[model samples]
Target: MSDDVRDSLIPYDEIVQDALRAVVGRVLSQIVGYDSLPGEHHFYITFKTQAVGVDIPAHLIAKFPDEMTIVLQNRFWDLKVEQDHFSVGLSFNQTPSILTIPYASITAFVDPSVDFGLQFQVSDDDDTQPEPHDEADNDRPEVISEDGSNVVTVDFGKKR
Candidate 1:
C-alpha cells in the first residue's frame, strides 16, 4: 500500500482549540452558579498576565513580572464569567483587587486534589508572545508557586 496523506476542508485545529477553551469558561460558570467551592475543590489558574483584557493588580504584576497564578476559594467575590473571559475580585494580604482574565490567556488549569489537569497549546498568532531569552534560558522554564497547593505548567516546547 502506498503511504499518502489526505487533506480535508475542515479546520480541526481551530475548532478543537475553541472547544477546549470553552471548557475553562464552563467550569468557571459552574463555580459561579454554585456560589461556593465544593468541599476542597479549589482551582489554581495560570494565565498570561500581559494578555489583552487581563486586569490583575499592580502589586501582583510587580511580584510576578511574567505570569501569575490565582486561587479561587474561601475569599473571592464578584465572580463573573463571560464568553471569552472572566473577572473576579480576590484579596491579597487583606487588600481587595479585581482581576480580569481572558480564556485564551489561560495556559494551565489543575485540580491536584484529584490529579486532574488540562494543558493548552497557544496559537502562534495570539497577541501574547513569549519573552525572548538566550538559548540556555529557553532550555529551562520558570516555575512560580504560591502555598504549594495545586500546580500546573505551560511549556511551549516541541513534544518529544
Candidate 2:
C-alpha cells in the first residue's frame, strides 16, 4: 500500500473546531445566571484581537493588536453567549471595556483550576494580520501534565 492519504472532502478541521468552540459556549451558558464561579473554576480565554467580528476598545486594539488573553474570574460582568459569539465586560488597567469575540477567533482556552486546556490552530486565511503590540505580562502559573491526559490540540495543516 502507498503511504499517501487521500484528502478529505469534508472539512473535518472546521467541524471539529466548531464543535470544540461549542464546548466553550456550553460552559459559559451554564454559568450565565450564577452570581459567581463555583469553587475556584475560572477560565483563561485567548483570542485573536484583529479577527473579523471581534469588537474591542481602540486602546485595547492598539495594545493587543494580534492576540489577547482574558481571565474570566472575579469582576467580570455582562457575559452574554450566543450561538456564534460571546460578549463580556472586563477591566484592564482600572479601565472598563466591553469585548465581543466570535468563537472562530479563539485560539486557546484553559481552565487551570482543573488542568484542562484546548489549543487551536489559527487559520492563515482568516484575515489576521499581525501588528505591533505592547507585550502584556501574564503571570499565570503553567500547568504541566506528564501523562498527557487533559489537553486537546488540533492541527489541520496539510503536509507536503
Candidate 3:
C-alpha cells in the first residue's frame, strides 16, 4: 500500500453513505408494510436534532440541542417512510409528538434484538461533531448489551 494517496474524481464515500442511509429507509418501509415489527426486531435511531429537513418539536430540540436517539420498539404509531425521511409518533414525558427525521441526519441505527447496528458519517452540511447530551429516555426500552459483533462503523478518514 502506498502512503501517498491521490484524491479521486468520484465521490465514493458519499455514494456509500447514501446507500447505507437507504438501507435504514428500506428497513423502516418494510416495517410500515407489515405494520409491526417482526419477531424481536426493534430499532434505536439516533439523529442530529438541528440537521436540515428534521421536523421535531421545539421542546425536543431544546432538550436535545445536538442529537437525539428514538426507539421504535413499542408505544409508537403513525410510522411513515418517505424517499429521504421518515416520521413517527412517539410520546416524550407523556406528550405525544410526531417527528420527521431525514435519513441524512441519522448517525446511528441499531436493532438491539439482533445486536445489529450501523453508524454513518455526518453529512457535508454539518462539520462539527455532536456534543454529548442526556439520553432521550422517552420510552422504557429494553437495555442493549455490550456485545458489538454485528455493528458496522465506516469512517472515511484521511488515507495514509
Which should have the higher lDDT, number 1 or number 3? 3
Candidate 3, residues 1-160: lDDT per residue as tens digits?
4434566878988898899999999989888845457789878898888889999999999989988888887678889999999999888889999999999999888887888888887855546766766667843343444565887776787455
List, residue by residue over 33-146, the lDDT tens digit for candidate 2.
564678899888888987899999998878787888888877788889999999998878888888999999998888878988887877866555566566664324444355
Give every collision pair in model 1.
Answer: none
Give candidate 2's TM-score.
0.86
User: What's the TM-score of every candidate structure?
Assistant: 0.69, 0.86, 0.84
Q: List the residue pairs that clash in candidate 2.
A: none
RMSD after Cα superposition, model 2: 2.7
Where model 2 places Cα greater than 4 Å from the true spot, the runs are: 1-5, 126-133, 137-146
Every model: Cα RMSD to truth = 7.1, 2.7, 3.1
- lDDT of residue 12 for candidate 1: 65
Clash count for candidate 1 is 0
By TM-score, the candidates rank as 2, 3, 1
The 10-residue segment with the lowest total lDDT in model 3:
138-147
Give the per-residue lDDT digits (tens) of candidate 1, residues 1-160. Answer: 3333434367665576677778888988987855457888877677767677788887776666556677776677889999999998877777888899998888777665555566666655554656642222112233334544343333444323
